[model samples]
Target: MMRSILERASHWLALVCRVIAGVALIAMLGVTIVDVATRYLDRLSDGAVAVTLLGSVELVSYLMLCSLLAAMAANVEKSQVVVEAFSHGLSPGFKHRLQGVYLLGFAALGLILCLGLVDSAAAAARHGEVTQDLRLPMGPIYTTAAVLSLLLGVRALIHALLGALFGAEGEVSHGE
Candidate 1:
C-alpha cells in the first residue's frame, strides 16, 4: 500500500509523542526526588512548608504513569522491542502469525483493565474525591488514563491485524 500523507503524519506525530512522554517522565522523576528530599530536609520554616508540593508530586506521578502508557504504545508501534531471539529460527510466516496472536492477547488485557476501572473512577468523580492538600479533582486523571489505555489497546489491535495481514514488522519494501 502506498504511504499516504496521513500515515506519514501519524508516524512523525508518534515520534514526537514519544519524545514528549520521555521528557515528562524525566520531569516526574525529578519532581518526586525533590519531594522526597525536602520532606526529609528537617529544616523548613513552619510557614514555609507548603502543602502544594505534595499535590504537585501526586500530579507528576499521575502524569508519569500516563506517559508510560503512551511510551509503551509508541514503542510497540515502532517495533522497538526485541523479540527475535526465540522466533529467529521460525519461518517468517509462522513468526508473523505468532506476533499477531501475542498482540491480540495484549490488547484484550488492556481492554479488561479499562473496563474494570471506569466505574470506580466515575464514583470518585461523582463524590468529589480530591487530594488531601490541593483538593483537585482526581476524576480527570482517572478518566484520562483509562481513555489513553483504551486507545493504546485499540492501536495494539490494529497493529496485530496489520501484522497478520502483511507479515510481522510491517517492513515491506516496494522496490525490492
Candidate 2:
C-alpha cells in the first residue's frame, strides 16, 4: 500500500527531532559530568586550584530545554497519557475521534507556544539580551525553540487530522 506524503514527511521530521533530542541529551550529560568533576576537583584542591566551568549551570539549563523540546514534536502522540476510565466503554471509532480532539488541543497549545517564543526571541534580539552566566545570545536560543514548537504544532495537527478522518494509528477507517 502507498502511504500519503504527509505520513512520510511527518515520519522523517520526527526522526530528525529524535536525533536532535539525542544530541541534546548527550551534550547535557557531558556538561553535567564535567561540572560535577569540577566540583570534586575543587574539593580535592582544598581551595588552592579553584577551577570552574563558569557557565556550566546555564549551559545545562539550555541543553535541558533543547532536549525536552526536541523530543516533543516527534513524541507527542506516542507520549500522550490517556485516562481510559472515561472512554473505556466507547467504541473504537468514538475513541479515535476523541483522541483526535485531544491532539487538536495539543496542536493549538503548540502553536501558542511557538508564537510566544517568537515574540520573546524578537524582544531579546532588540534588547541585546544575553544569558546571565554564559552570556550566550538569547535570541538564537529562543528562535530555535520557536521553530521546534512550530514543528510540534504541525505534527500534532497532522496527526489530529489523520485520526479524525481515518481512525486510530494503524486501523483503517470504514473502507480505507
User: For all the candidates, what are their Cα RMSDs to the real structure?
Assistant: 4.7, 3.6
Give me the overall lDDT of model 2. Answer: 0.81
Best model number under lDDT? 2
Best by TM-score: 2
Q: Where does candidate 2 stray beyond 4 Å?
A: 1-3, 170-176
List TM-score per model, in order: 0.70, 0.89
Output the worst ten-in-a-row residue range by lDDT, candidate 1: 167-176
Q: What clash pairs does model 1 have?
A: none
42 in model 1: Cα distance from truth in Å? 7.7
Error of 2 at 160 (Å): 0.3
Write candidate 1's Cα lDDT for 43-150 as tens digits: 464547554355765668677887887776565545534367776788876666677667887678668767766776898888988866668787876776677567
Question: Quick one: RMSD of model 1?
Answer: 4.7
- What TM-score does candidate 1 get on C-alpha atoms? 0.70
